[model samples]
Structures are given as structure tokens and as C-alpha cells.
Target: MLWGALPYMVIVFCITATIWRYVTNPFSWTSKSSEMLEKRLLRWGSLLFHIGIFAVICGHIAGLLVPIEFYHWIGLSDEAYHMGAVFGGLPAGIIAFAGLVILLVRRYTARRVRATSSVGDWLALAMLIIVIVTGILATSANAVNHSGFDYRTTINPWLRGLLVFQPDPALMQTVPMNFKVHILLTFVLYCVFPFTRLVHMLSMPLGYLRRSYVLYRRRDGAIYPNQNQEQQKERAM
Candidate 1:
């Protein structure tokens, strides 16, 4: 009951809080990048972390949302599907872990960033690393240790049940300890996500794709925007 209910409760609270935050303090909905203070590590770390996270999210969606019956229908045996999960999940998890290491290092070493960092920042970073580490361990157990554990039969259905409002905690009871840690931490991350820089995710500027680009042209010694507006007001006066 705790496992099933906790995730939904966290998600609901996060959604409600996120909406309130965005509505009341829209300008604060940002990642608040500190790249200007230190670009060297930031560039590499940000690229790897974001890309790895994208891959991880994709993998999670496929594993959790797609039904196991679908794989059987497609003629993929359980062993084959497990192989695919290990092969795909391991690399992505490792890349994300590496990037997270660099980011954590940068967070502490960069004087300006460190000075400005809050308790929430450190807490978020620590939890993120823990989640990634546990996830890699779970995947590695099957890939390296050859335990042949299949999460499709366990975690996947539990998640689907949660989606339909028929959460069954029993579904997650048999999940490995590492995997349980991963799931708990992930939802905890979701709960904290709105109050942190992750809130920027919701404000993705997708409109930029359809919006017209700025066409810069040589304006000689023409006034800037504010100056141009001031001149217009003067003429009106």
C-alpha cells in the first residue's frame, strides 16, 4: 500500500505545488544555470547528464508502459527481452552516473556556484546520484551477475495499475531492494522537482520551433529598442 500510494501521492502533490509556483512566481520557473561562472566542466557535464537522462527516461517508459504480452506477441522470448533491457539500460545508466559525478564535483569546486548553492541544491544532487547508482546496480546484477531477474512481470504491471487508479502494492513487494530504492527515490525526486530547478522542464520553449527567427541586419548607428521608443515618444510630445 505504501509503495503504490506513495508514488501517486507524491505526483499529485508535485502537480498541485508546481501549478501554484508557476502561477504565482512564473519568472522563477527556471533551471537557473550557473554556466557563466564556470563553463569548462559545466559544458561537458550538462551535455552528458541531459543526454543520458533523456535516454534513461526513454528506457523507463518502454520498460514500464509497454506490456510484456506485447513482447510475446512480437515473438520476443523473455530471455531475449531481458537481454535487450540489460544491454540498453546499463550504458545509459552508466553515462548518467558519470555525468552526475562531474556535475556534483563542479557544484562543489566552482567557487561562485558553491557560494550560491542552497541546501536544496545539495540534497537534490545527493538524491539524484543515489537513485542513479541504485538503478545501475539493479541493471548490472542481471547483466554482470546473470541473476536473470525480469522486472517486466513485477514493476511494470504495478506502474500500469497506478496509472489506472487501481494501485496494488503487492505487485511491488517482490521487487529487489535496489530496485525498490530506485523507485522510491525517483518519486521523491518528482516530489521535490517542482521546488527545484527541474521546474524548468515544464517551461520548455517548444514554440521556438514554430516562431519566426530574429533576422539581424546591419542598422548602422540606429538607436536600440528603448532609445527608439524614447525617440518616438519625444516626436509624439
Candidate 2:
């Protein structure tokens, strides 16, 4: 398993580095255009995508950090958890998938957008789709594996340990190959975030709001000097 993941990790790291270089020097490209439609699409699409992504992250964090007892306390029995996983995860996945598809279609289908889009932009969208789709598959498969020594319960702990710098092959053995692929794709997306247009993910929406127009006025106004005013001034002098 370790040997298999090595190639993916290496590719992810390389692509990540390349993306970072471009992001840091985006201004090197002399030509760019801004359209209101594109701006609005980005604004709203980003909002939905960010909110949904945040929820997904929170769900993952909860699974990893929250104790089973805590879940039971909140009226989530193992059965409830399994059912919730299916019902909750499927719709969320579908929504995320839709958002990603819309963003991608906008990039390719819109002439103005396509003109300004870099290779990094398309690649970022593709990577996101890959990650989301794989996650959806993993979630669906997890429902099927609930009766057995499940991948999430057995393999995820090992992967978590690896993330924390402790690798365990025995625990990893429980993870299905497809699950590993999903995990790897996600890691690749993370590695690429700082380098691609995806860095927008890290930007503050408050900045957009700040750019919005605010009204203000000068306390005093000076009118332009016309011929009449000049003659009047001359006569007074």
C-alpha cells in the first residue's frame, strides 16, 4: 500500500509546486479581462461551494475527533449514524458535484471566460471534480461495507496516523484500493490549493464586500473659474 501511494504523492507534490509558482506570478500574463457575469458567477458559485465544502470538512472532523459516546449522547446510535451517512452524504455530494460541473462548464463554454482561463484553472476544476466524485463513491461504498470490518473504521485510523507522521501497514491493509485512491486525490487537491485559482478558496469574502461602492462627500466645493468670474475679479482688482 505504501509503495502504491508513493507515485501519487510524488505527482501531487510536483503539481503543487508548479501551481504555487504560477499563483505567485499571476501578473506575468499581460492580458486579462473582467466581466460582470463572470464576477457574479464566481461570487455565488464560490459561496455555495465554500459553504458546502465547510460542511463536508466539519463532518470529517467530527468523525475523526468526536467520540462514539458523544454521538450516542446526541441520539445517534450506530444504526442512526449509518443511515445518516447515506442520506446526508448523498445529497451533499450531489450538490457539490453540481456546483463543480457548473463552474467547469462556465470556464469552457463561455468565450470570454475560456480566453482568460489558464491551464491551472481547468486543472483545478478537474481535480476538484475527481476528489468530490471519489468521495461520493467512497461514501456509497461505505454503506455497503457497514456490516463487515468497514474501511472507514479500520483503514481511516491508519491513514490519520500516517498524516500525523506515524505509518502503519497493518491498519492500512483494511482500506480498499478505491478508498486509497479517493484519499490520494484529496491530498493532491490540498497540495494544489495554494498554486491554482483555487487559492480563492483561502481569500476572505469581506474583501469583495469592501470593494463595493461606499458614498462619501467633500465638505466644500470649488466651482471652475469662467470668463464672467474672471472679468468680475479683474474689475474688482
Best candidate, TM-score:
1
Best by lDDT: 1
Model 1 over residues 120-163: C-alpha lDDT tens digits? 78877888888888888878865677665678888899889989
- What's the count of clashing pairs in each model shown? 0, 1
lDDT score, candidate 1, position 19: 96
lDDT of each: 0.83, 0.66
Model 2: per-residue Cα lDDT at residue 198: 61
Candidate 2 segments whose C-alpha is farther than 4 A from its true place? 1-44, 67-75, 144-152, 205-237
RMSD of 1: 5.1
- TM-score per candidate, chains pooled: 0.86, 0.69
Give the lowest summed-lDDT range of ten residues in model 2.
217-226
Candidate 1 lowest-lDDT run of ten: 217-226
Residue 116 of model 1: what lDDT? 86
Superposed model 1: Cα runs more than 4 Å off: 210-237
